[model samples]
Target: MKKLLLLLFSFALFGLWSERNVQSVHASTIASERLYRLYNPNSGEHFYTKARLEKQQLVALGWQDEGTGWYAPVTGEAVYRLYNPNAGDHHYTLSAGEKEALVAKGWRYEGVGWYSAPSNADYAKPLYRAYNPNALAGSHNYTLNKAEQTYLTSLGWQDEAIAWYGVNLPSPLIVDLSEWQSPSKIDYDTLANQIDGAIVRVYTGYRADNNYQRHLTELQKRGVPVAVYAYVAPSDTLAEINAQATQFYHLASSFQPKFYWLDVEDEYLSGGLTDGTSIRDAMESYRLTLATNGASKIGAYIANNRFATFNLDTTKFQAIWVPTYGDNSGYYENNAPDSTENFALHQYTSTARLKGYDGSLDLNRLSGQVSFAQLFS
Candidate 1:
């Protein structure tokens, strides 16, 4: 009897172990499936279900798996550093007075700089490290425009372009418009001759721009390549996002401009939502919906202040347009932060005056490989 009892106990233990092994395998499979990001372009929703049946169901309903939606988080707390061979390395404390004092002390103000680092387990991919020439002991420096670089070079400081980040030295001149500016007197040929391309606001929320079609017609008439943008105001729910995407697609598809941009700003997504990650997810859904339907050439137009405040991941968009009014004048000016990529298009001034128009216009500068002619083709 004792021998029989021992044999039964051993069997019971083996059964428990086998069950635990099966559960572990099951859990791992679920985790892997959850990591595979999926989006429904038609519905403007994101899904992370691990069930094979659920995935099949979504696929039948026009869901697209966008792979992983994970990205390396970039912290914006790095300081723009300055170095002096004589006085040593100094970091700017976000104080104009402190920077001026450093300049007075003959310290060379290096552009936005960061410590060079290799890919870690957390990042997996190579994280974007700021380019620092000196590799001196201090925090990274900020970015400098052509004007700022020229000024630093004049002061006998070495100027080397960013190692990884490449931007066109001088940005191509361009302009953006909406219904607010009356360009009735404006000649399309003259405007095209003056600028490389044009970006216009096609829709603001659910309301289509009053003059989007007219503006596109005029631009096309003059052989000018044009891009269009729709202002996004995502609600707390996925259904609301789908509605916005549907409205925007119907209006923007008619023109078929070179690029389609989602303009996220001014309490649009932030009005009702407080979670930055949720807002990011909502915008991603909006972009995905546009891409799946027809607008594949998508980009983002976000101001510097809002971009940082919202902690947006610009990498998701094929291109980025940033507006920064440093000088706040008619002339184009740029003071973009070095921490982020120097956008594809920079709206340097919103109050620029041109010969063909009476009121002020938003002026932009195209950098890198942003081609005006290619966009039309």
Candidate 2:
């Protein structure tokens, strides 16, 4: 009788242990089935997941769970997003005046707002057409939005009420090089692999960039796309403007660069040329001289804030490149220009650190309708 009782007690304890172990396993499975929200505070990005195990997996790969949260769909309001085919940038605005102003300046409405709720994706309807007679074989210059027959009567391009063939978004990487970046120090192989193209400094006033030819040769050897820019100083006379343009033309014409840009910063405007009218007239002379010398696709490189100080006539150049370093270093949204259409190229960051390079470099993005291929083609 005693042996039987002891055996019963041992079996009961074992059963209890087994039940507890089973309950613990069930609890873990339930926890694994819960939902989570992972957030990256640094980049202000958020992600959602239903599996706790999946969340844990992402956490292991450098994500943090902000906590339990539900996903809310954003209901998009109908607003216009204007696109400039010449400059690869878009402007989102609700004002009719703003929209009309952009249309006059050659921006095409893509037809829908960006904030449409996920369930009902809004598609842009083609109402008008934009054409660029000067555009190359495969260029965005040939396309525009909406019916602009009346508007077309005043402009240079033909308004064909046809949809664009296709959108070929260009690779956005572009690097600017000057005498400061030596040819011997540049890792052309790495640079070519990393970037879509390069804009090399040809001359500043009458002095040529010492590394200009060597850099051009390296890029050409690597099959990298190339462009050229010349730094300019404020001049009161057409003679001085012609001298700078002549110097720029001689070096620039040899390469037949994809594009030519004039570097005009606040320093040039500050040297006793505060009168906006004078500044506009001075730039016109330079532009005309370059055109006469056979420099194709001319552009201007200036700071956004300085645009008003100089009262520049931006339409004079084929394109504009603006430098707006968010901080003193120059690459952040805080420093972006007030008007996106003012610039075709935005040199947002000047302190970009590339691998195998000793110093910081200027980084730029295409804001205009033109692309790397379009500019080259």
Candidate 3:
């Protein structure tokens, strides 16, 4: 009788261990599933998916991979996916009532997108929602970040409350910076942690920006990556271009910029010289001068609408930087430059307001898979 009793006790312990192990395995599986996020610049739309293939397809179709938006579970409440045929945008929700409501308003229910976590689940996190009242397409926005939701509302976006529950939500990578965000204007200690890289203005076409050296020394002291750019006047004589580029290299070389960008704007043709030939000549002069003066990585900062009109060679430069602010709302709406120029970096917004900084900043992000090392190297 004793022997039988001991065997049964051992079996009960083994059963308990197996049950806990299975539960842990399920939890791991749920946590491993990530909801990939992407942005459509042309359409101002954001997309999320649990399918790697779909994410890859959209990325291949020119979408910006915004990385994982949140984490889903192996099984829970079904999140329905809907498509507005007329607007050409996608929407997802966890409520059957909300799904039907949009469907009734001409949104075709594609099917269940991904599973949401159970209410008040320990691993679950809230996904905040927002709506752009001014937009007819790509109106709704969802994020797992409360700060981002708050920022959007400050920019005229309406808060729509928590859309669903997820296990993980990541901070968006907004690494690029510029001269406008200076030590006097913003906290350097905070800026150091926030900046991935910065491009300070050397010359603004007619004269040098006074903060160029100060910004450089500050960034260098903090071990922050730095670059230099000079705004070139379109009607600038070959002599002026040569002198400015040379002066820029000589003074700024000690700080060791990763790239020397020539800012060529069509709007700043000195003396109203709109000749495309003169513009191209001025651009080329600055580029060639920089190259001759030992600047290894020369980049061109061109306005999106000036690609054809300015007649830029583009092949002469190592990298292309284009500015195209979709709404100029001071936030990146993933608006790609409307140009044929094959660009390496994008200056998305000139009015970005970063934490610790009170003034507007020109923010940039790399195009496609381009990296800091590749641009500099």
Candidate 4:
């Protein structure tokens, strides 16, 4: 009876051990499928998941699952995973301390087959950083007359020439009617014919004016692109700014200017208001406001010195219009190199000879001197 009892006990113990082994195997398989193992070639570090790697790298990094034969997110790469039986060999056993160490070294954790990163993981891609928001404003200093336009064309200022004088023509000076002494005196038909394909800028504020309306009508009739400029009050509260913007939106809805320009020159005159918030915070607020309001394109018009002096975050603005005179050469000539990189256009070369309705106006010119396509692209 004793011998029989011992034999039964031994059999029960063996069965328990076998069952535990099976559970362990199942757990490991599940973990393998749920976690993606990554090895950083540069750091010679292995990560159990992409999240583990990202926390360490602060950059977009990724890995692949060998068992699933899937590629994972990496620096500048999209997030995707695959499954392959061969990936089993890629798996590495790691202790808690090892995992922590890997994460500390900029490794990220990600899932294996049929698993994905957490929804809130920072999965944003890096974009081309803007260099200077006010780089293009200085381009307005040059003349857009026939000779000047031709010279600009030679220097690859095609977009500026078109925006200023209309068609990419080499000759035929189409005077800006608004700048004429008697805009109404000039025959609409003659002016239209001259500016058959010239682009024009119109100031469209909340205040209604016949001159602005007439110009809008004529420009629409001529199929020329029009852009509105609003002299924004920097100190104005959000409500006041929104009111002004809404008014402009309604008025220009029909005209549909390509975009709106927030003229931010003369900080004092326009209620010099600078947010005490950090530059990043201020810029973020501005950008969010413009974006939420559905402004197709928003730009800033700042003077050269102001841009240089103010530690403004230029990235918030789509494009910057720097008001510098004469070829934009010496506009920010004395200013130090800008660290913030956000610029699309440069308003260089203002012609002092031209006059607007109010008085001698600064005829600003833009140049393709900068890589605008790359900046905005």
- TM-scores vs. true structure, each candidate: 0.52, 0.52, 0.54, 0.40
- List lDDT for all candidates, in order: 0.56, 0.59, 0.71, 0.38
Instruction: Put the candidates in lDDT order, highest first.
Output: 3, 2, 1, 4
lDDT of 4 by residue, 1-377 (tens): 00145644654565587687643211111111112234444433333332323333522454332221111221211222211232221222113454445446554433222232222322211111111223332222223245645664556544332211111111112223232324455444433432212223343333643365677676567544456555544443444455656665555557766656666554453323343343334334554565576666777666666665555566666666654333222111222224233443444322212111222222233333343232222
Off by over 4 Å in 1: 1-171, 234-236, 271-277, 369-377
What is candidate 2's local distance difference test score?
0.59
In terms of lDDT, the poorest run of 10 residues in model 1 is 25-34
Tens digits of per-residue lDDT, candidate 2, 14-119, equal 5577687743211111100112456544443344444456677978878776654321111223335577777444454445677789899998976543221122
Question: For model 3, how does the per-residue alpha-carbon lDDT over 85-188 read when each residue is reduced to its tens digit?
Answer: 99999988888998899999999999989788766654467889999989877899999889999999999999999988865322222334444455678666
Candidate 1 per-residue C-alpha lDDT over 79-124 given as tens digits, one digit per residue, 9 for 90 to 100: 3446565634445333446666887988887654322212222112
Worst 10 residues of 3 by lDDT: 23-32
Number of colliding residue pairs in each model: 7, 20, 0, 57
In model 1, how many backbone clashes occur? 7
Give model 4's TM-score versus the native structure.
0.40
Candidate 2 stretches with Cα past 4 Å from truth are: 1-171, 270-277, 328-335
Cand. 2 TM to true fold: 0.52
RMSD of 4: 31.9
Q: Model 3 segments beyond 4 Å from truth?
A: 1-182, 234-236, 266-277
